[model samples]
Target: MNATHTTFAQDNGLRNIPAVDDFSGMINHPNPLIRESSPLLGFTVRVKTLLDPPEDKKLIDLIEQDIRHILLRLEAERYEPGILISWSYFFCTFIDEMVMARPWGIECWAQHTLLVRFHSETWGGEKCYQLINRLLLEPSRYHDLLEFIHLCLCLGFQGRYRMTAQYQEERERILRLIHQKLQSVRAQQPAERTALLSNTVIHVGSTERERRYRLHGLLSVKKIAWMMAFIALAGFLLFNWQLHIQTENIIDRLDVLLP
Candidate 1:
């Protein structure tokens, strides 16, 4: 099945959904867009986060062209356009929170700037994950999966490996085995591996990315706050200036009438 199947939400196991209050594990991992979201409490992956926002002309126009089709399938309302910005920030971040904000392990695999959209469903929460498991074992997508898995390990995402002490040995064993498989594949296709690995290089703190951009989009909150403050201050000054001028004219009129 393709990534946008309607039945995807129904097949998800119980463990896939996280408790709404507990933002631990992948769920709590750095969101790159938390600074931009006004997420409502008690909902799965969203709310005022969507309900309404100041309309940004640039963002709204971009959504009309690119994102409106892929999200919020049931209602005509697409999510708030401000949270969804130039990096395809809103949609990608939405997907991340829904998938990563988890008490559960991501059982499978998976955009933006130029996102690949499928019209069948708004891939969010359970439905988003359902798409992942459906495509988990497919070889074409597996490469992308491994690419993501590599980054997740580097980012300290432990998933089910940290869920139990019994899984500890299994974790090490799985690591070694996967490493072995990678070696075998690399040995067989060194050139292909090299080309793929060399395609993108991201500097992630002490580590880096050997794949396409995943979690790199971040908007500086300090700068945003400062910019907003400056704008408000300027508007206040302008309003005061106008008010002062009006007051002075009123005083002049009163003096002329009294004389």
Candidate 2:
């Protein structure tokens, strides 16, 4: 293994970490099936294992380390686009699992968001955006729609390109669609309605975070303006106080001259 890979393995706890070097060696193995299946099977199994126990810190660290390594390899042209896509799906599956499990925590949500952004960058912006939009709008996949919306908002707010006007328009349209759907389902059944409302709340929270991110620059500007105003006021008060002292001194001098 290379120095970089060795460092990553060490950081993540090497006990169960997949040795990418071993897989690299198998690229030229005589058995065609082993050569073809080794990497994909190994990668899939490692990722799936990370999802078990759901709250395993070591597994989470290992998965994150692996994700960074994969992205680095992709950027360096060491991996094919197909391999990147497979990894993207694996990450998406993990997100879906989290969503299905009730009471999703912030750490898992953050990890999934990072994976989504990485996938978007590696898969090409337009393709990933389209995939997310399709998933968000699909009625059959409503259970996972909130996560998809969060992904879109993440892209719009933090992506290198930012979201275009067209993307923003589409996002608003989808939000409205979801709202309408939620309303229609409200009177049908209590359990279903409650679930949809919860998802909507989660989606709204993400949108609010995006809104805050967008406003960050404006907020900083306002803060600077307030500080400048405060300083100007303080300077004005100091000048007036000095002028008052000078006037009192002149009056005393005049009184002394009259005496």
Candidate 3:
């Protein structure tokens, strides 16, 4: 079976027929210039088309193209660079195995600058996995998945895309495993492993500076406090000792025990 057939067969009787079919009709209308009279109908139609596709390759192609074009055009103006990068990274690197925030492959456009889209269906929690899984089930669409994963991971969480010490450690640990897998592959080049290690080290180095500086600052503060406490105790003891010697001399003289 072709990609469309496979997709349709898998979704057969599994999705809401009315909703899927309704959405399909709205999206499949011939005239591109005409506005969808009913926004609700348009959304349902789009959803239905994806849920229920005919076996026609051209139809499937058109549907895919339309969905992508519409979504991109709708989202392009948002321009969230951090989310875009983070979404791109996740979409590319991770697999949608556990229904968690796994990567779905997708790419970034340089000028777009935005790292992510804010739609719930796209990157809003668990729904993103459903979208990703649906896309991967169809052939010739893995590239989009790759791009999404890369941007998502690279962007990390929000505008704070740069790796912190903890995050850098985690990334290195993941890369270490990837490198191990690469090594196990037959005929893999030595340079590949070296490059992976180098990248991991570089990432760690980038974030280490901040962690080290904070640690050093903390230690310095502790050291200063400890020094002050020790000086205070020493002064107290010295003063007490000198007073005791003077008191003893005065007592001997008063008692006339030592003249």
Candidate 4:
């Protein structure tokens, strides 16, 4: 994180697209989950240069070893959540890069790697204290984590949540939950929390957040406008019902008189 990387564009967890020309920044961890993930450094270069059959085998093997080691430490709760998150982001980014580079045919290189383990199952479940701890307790950094999670989904880091109808439905459920959470938080701590958490728009596979400013913008409308709109809707329904009743009555009378 000490690495000075420029952020071109960002919204919530969506991070700046750091130029991968220099793999140094991506590899530098403040406190690496393991001793050194430096062996994984060759990833950026290989992804950029060559994705040959032999090279694919080596890349797959190295990433798998490092990930397995990290997952073991995670189970032991040996690393801090922040450090774990940094490594999680790195792993997610690795998958994103692989998707862009597409190494082995149509299937993603992630399923072949340990991305599924780190992203889902191995972390245990929703109750896991290691990663979800920071997420629940630290409201300030919620966007940061959510952004990376969204990025993973966007770039196809399918783990327990595969790229299917279920995957997208889960994504929406998370988005909806965050909106409700922020709304509650904002109401309770309007002054302090509003600026910290705000908006994240959705576009194909993007993590939706902040339901737009227009929801809060409702405060700007005139009371009379609301009253008029309500009255108009009521009046229309009332007239339609009255007209139907009148027609039914007339039809009955005509039938009776004819009979």
Candidate 5:
């Protein structure tokens, strides 16, 4: 959690932002508690970046292949495939590595290329690890934030992250732009509307097993009552049969004594 800030002006091809006073000083992995774990390196790989894409693709591809392979291996142990296939911020470091290491490396490349699309775009390099940690520290709807960040990275790279508002009032403005674009598109196109509505409905619908689970409890109550009633009736019939057998035995004994 150790951090120090130093300011920077745009020099060469670098963006106008702060730089780490000393990256090595800021990053302390040699702490007595820390281990030389590759997963930790994998975590570092997410926040770490190269100056350019072409030169770095080789390493990036290796990281992605590792992530994908691990994901597949984990999949066999899990009942749900989408859990590993989907997103979570806790694994952002791993995810970031996977994205960069993939064939397209679209997500990683976009973070470098598309950050300008958002209002609080900071190209803080590995220092971004601290920033992401800060933003996601508290308990909140983090999955949504991850989705938003993912969208920002992709859109920003495409140069679609535009300055639609005055400084400091920018994020809300971009959201409005997004909504407007979708609204207009939906209004103009029927196919898009149908697809959107269908997807929404499908998402809302309950799964068959969930429906069966809910119904099973109610069905069990009736079954228990029926079983209890049958047991009571059998007990009543057995009592009468035992009484009649005793009476017949007594009558035979009395006849034999009178004879």
Candidate 6:
């Protein structure tokens, strides 16, 4: 059987959908111009159609293009806040689809969305915050949640995005979840520990360990330096006392001889 036949069989007799690249070309076709009459509805139709088939090769690229198209329409329509919120929710659904279809590409799609749409000056923080909350609440979209938090951290560290109190709280909560997951994995499979530790979620914990190690080393060095200083002072005092005693004895001998 050919690759296409295998992909179709994987879908269990559902309509044989074209690959994402082919579908993307269809969406980008100039003829019927993705009807702006109801952009959200049209976009939803496209998303559902593409997701109907189980095979998701190049899915992330197609979603990125879809988001770009939506953003362009929003810009042309002059920032309708309501429509933008709808778009945010729509993208959140994409996270669920990604989690269900293929787990690995979720991170790439999430990072792309953050850098392209959420980080855009045109997109409001309120909308971004709402979307993030939605992702966090979903139990299965942990990868997306973690990647979003990571992107936020990267942006905040670069001074591109401000880290607000709410964002900080979210970060802490996600880190706690990650630590718990890491511990669970370690308890279950000792051999898998190394691989799990390499995940992005473990970064915060590793950084804390490194910081504590440096602090411990600094304290140890300070203690050693203090001991060395104390020993040097004592030796200097003892030497001075011994020299004084020898000088006094010589002076007494000189006096007696002169008499």
lDDT-superior candidate, 5 or 6: 6
Q: What's the true lDDT of residue 176 in model 6?
A: 52
Question: Of models 3 and 6, which has the larger lDDT?
Answer: 6
* Full-model lDDT for every candidate: 0.35, 0.42, 0.32, 0.43, 0.34, 0.39
lDDT of 4 by residue, 1-259 (tens): 2134222111122132333433343243222332233323323333443344332334444455555655455546455566455556556445445444455522545454444545552222232223433564654445434333432333333343433555556645554554445445444553433432322211123234322211131121357478889999999999999999999999999999998
What lDDT tens digits, residue by residue, belong to model 1 across residues 48-153? 1233322332322333342343233312223344223322322442433433334331222122211234232333333322333443344242433333333333
Off by more than 4 A, model 2:
1-121, 136-138, 146-167, 182-193, 199-259
TM-score of 2: 0.29
Tell me each candidate's TM-score: 0.26, 0.29, 0.20, 0.35, 0.23, 0.24
Give candidate 6's whole-model lDDT: 0.39
Reference-based lDDT, residue 54, model 4: 30
Per-residue lDDT tens digits for candidate 6, residues 64-177, read 555555556545645445445544443444333323333443553544443344434332445444554554454232332333333222212212123354455455454455
Instruction: Please report, as a residue range, the 10-residue window in candidate 2 with the lowest summed lDDT.
Output: 196-205
For candidate 1, the TM-score is: 0.26
- Which stretches of model 6 miss by more than 4 angstroms? 1-121, 142-145, 154-259
**Least well predicted 10-residue stretch by lDDT in candidate 3:** 196-205
Root mean square deviation (Cα) for candidate 5 = 23.5
Compose the digit string of candidate 5's lDDT tens values, residues 1-259: 2233211111222242233222232123221111111232223333334334433444444444444444444445442433342222223333343345445566445554222322234332343334334434421323223322323332221111122324323433433443334333333443322232111111110223222211011123457589899999999999999999999999999999998
Candidate 1: where is the Cα deviation over 4 Å? 1-141, 190-192, 197-259
Each candidate: RMSD: 23.8, 20.9, 21.6, 11.2, 23.5, 19.4
Best TM-score goes to which candidate? 4
Tell me the deviation in Å of residue 163 in model 5: 6.6
